[model samples]
Target: MGILSRASYVIRSKVNAVLNRSEDPTETLDYSYEQLRDELQDVKQGIADLTTQKKRLQIQKRRLEENVEKHNDQARQAVEQDRDDLARQALEKKKQKMSQIEELEGQISQLQRQQDQLVEQKDELQRQIEQFRTKKETMKARHEAAKASARVNEAMTGAGDEMEDVSRAIERAEERTEDMEARAQAMDELRENGALENQLDDRSSLEKELDAVQQDGEVDAELDTLKSEMGKEEEPTANGGDEAAETELEQELEDDTVSDVEVDDSEVEAELDELKDEE
Candidate 1:
């Protein structure tokens, strides 16, 4: 049983391999339909040839039969006249002609059988081609649908990446805005607690120093004494000789002699007389 089964499996495998090599069912179906059409044409030609041959054979057969009938009639006449040799020759020719007619009839029958078989095969192949065409269309539609689904999934996934990036960007912007808001609130609180006022006093001190920088020391001191108390420093003078010495030193530096002119009572009287005259 196993050997038989293995033989049958081998036969099926060979048939399947041959079928696979011959053509792809989808492609073969199309080519088979074309070949079937050609085969049908060949069948038509074969039928026509067979029909013509059959007609020719029938005509020949009929002519041979008529000859045989005429020969029989002649043979009957010959026999009535007592000539047996001519009648015997006529019967022999008739037998040979009948054999040829039978041969022609057999050939026609064989050709007709082959033509019918070809026509049946053509029809069956055409039906299979149509079935394969429908299946191919379904397969093509499935492929297109799968591709479209993949594209849709890819587009959705790409959009998800963009949405993630946009979400992160929005989160960063919100964080920056919150940080700025917090800083502004801190500044406001500092102002409310007099810390900002203390900074203003520091600025006022800088302005006062700037104003005092361009003034003379006494002026700065007077302004400072207004802010505080004033203190005085003492100095010393030598004597009454200091004034006479300073006058003599001044006349000597100027190269003028004090005794260059006589100081007389008459000159004093003259200066007094002039003063009296002017009065």
Candidate 2:
């Protein structure tokens, strides 16, 4: 095809596609039904007009026939009275009326035929309108049902943008979780690689020595308090039997008392090891 022709064809196809998409099947059916009804109305109107003309012609023909009968009676009365000229005039007038009646009859016949044709056309149009209406209604219902199905399908399918947003959100959540996990692992590595040494690095040898001395003083004070409490519990009573009962109670209370002191021999050895390591 020529370029211009091809371009025109493309434009026409596009326009038709757009129109097809925009047009609703239900609305188109309704419009077609309305058009058929309008046509039916027009046919009925034509029948009415033809019937009116036929009635008018029938009335005219009837009047003309009455005048012809009146002329015939006048001719009979004139022959009896021997008035030939008047009778001839009456007959001539009667002939003219009969001619007019004949013309009117013809006109009435034509009108009747036209009325009959229009009536038949009106009936056919009515039948067609009814049939078309039924079809249109069916089409409309189907179109509505199809449209509802299409809407449901569209919702089920989901919009690309919403799906994309969900995907992006999931990706972001995964990325955030990975970042948190990496941070946690890194912290674990820092701890495993002796992060405590880094904190100790912030102190000078003099501060370490002072801290050990302070810790020793606190240990000594705690030990003195424990010893004083033990001495009070172990105080010799004036009675030997009371002293034996106190010794038995002291053995039972040792576990409880030591739990509060928190300064076991292992802890003391660990403190000594820390001091040596620092040196």
Candidate 3:
């Protein structure tokens, strides 16, 4: 195809596409039905006009025929009365009336043919219009139903799209929440490890620190009582061990008899005094 031809074809296609997209089948059918009804009305009106004209022509022909009969009677009476010229004039008028009647008859016949054709046409047109109306209504109903179904389908599609988006959004939200929780847990673990290293010398040290911070005077009082009781338990055992050691040493010294040896009175007196001082 030529460039211009291709361009025209493309333009026509676009126009057709626009028209098809914009067209409503139900409205088109209704408009076509209205047009058919209007045509039917025109046909009916034409038939009525033709019938009216035919009737008028028939009336005119009847009057002319009556005049022709009257003229014939006048001619006969004039001929019987021996007035040939009047008879000729009467015959001439009758001929003229006959011609008028003949013309009226022709007009009436033509009008009758036209009226008959118009009636036939009207009937056929009416039948066609009725058939078209039925079909139009059927088509319009179907179109309306289809349009409603399409609207329902569109709504369902929109809902489906929204639901799909919502589902994805929920999934994304859940993922974010999970990531946030994981991050929070990781930070908490790091904080716990760091705090344990710096503050909690041992596992129980954290508990001891917490208890110390939280304790009232009652805990200190209880600790004091426990320390006093431990002191009392150690005091008896320490004093008893020292006393038993002194007694054992005294027995051992008494059991040992001094070696028999000549000694001076002064030395003996000094030794005895020392022993007394030691006791």
- Maximum-lDDT candidate: 2
Candidate 1, residues 1-279: lDDT per residue as tens digits?
A: 699999999999999899887754445545755775676667667666766776776677678778767766777776887778877776777777777768767876776676677667767766766776677677667766886897788667755566678878999999999999999999999989956665535567667667668566769676565444322222233687867887888888676554565668988999999867755
TM-score of 1: 0.36
Cα lDDT, model 2, residue 81? 92
Q: Which model scores highest in TM-score?
A: 2
Give the range where candidate 1 is weakest over 10 consecutive residues by summed lDDT.
228-237
Clashes of each: 0, 0, 0
TM-score of each: 0.36, 0.58, 0.57
User: In candidate 3, which residue pairs get closer than 3 Å at backbone N, Cα or C atoms, i.e. clash?
Assistant: none
For residues 113-197, what per-residue lDDT tens digits would candidate 3 score against the true structure? Answer: 8888888888898899889988988888888898789778866776556667887899999999999999999878988786525
Model 2, which residues run further than 4 Å from truth?
A: 1-8, 159-279
What is the TM-score ranking, best to worst?
Answer: 2, 3, 1
lDDT of each residue in 1-279, candidate 2, tens digit only: 999999999999999999998998888888888888888888888888888888888888888899999999998889889999989988999999999998898888888888888888888888888898888888888888987897777667755566668878999999999999999998889889855355647887788789999999999887777668557544557888878887988987997776765568998899999867755
Superposed model 3: Cα runs more than 4 Å off: 159-279
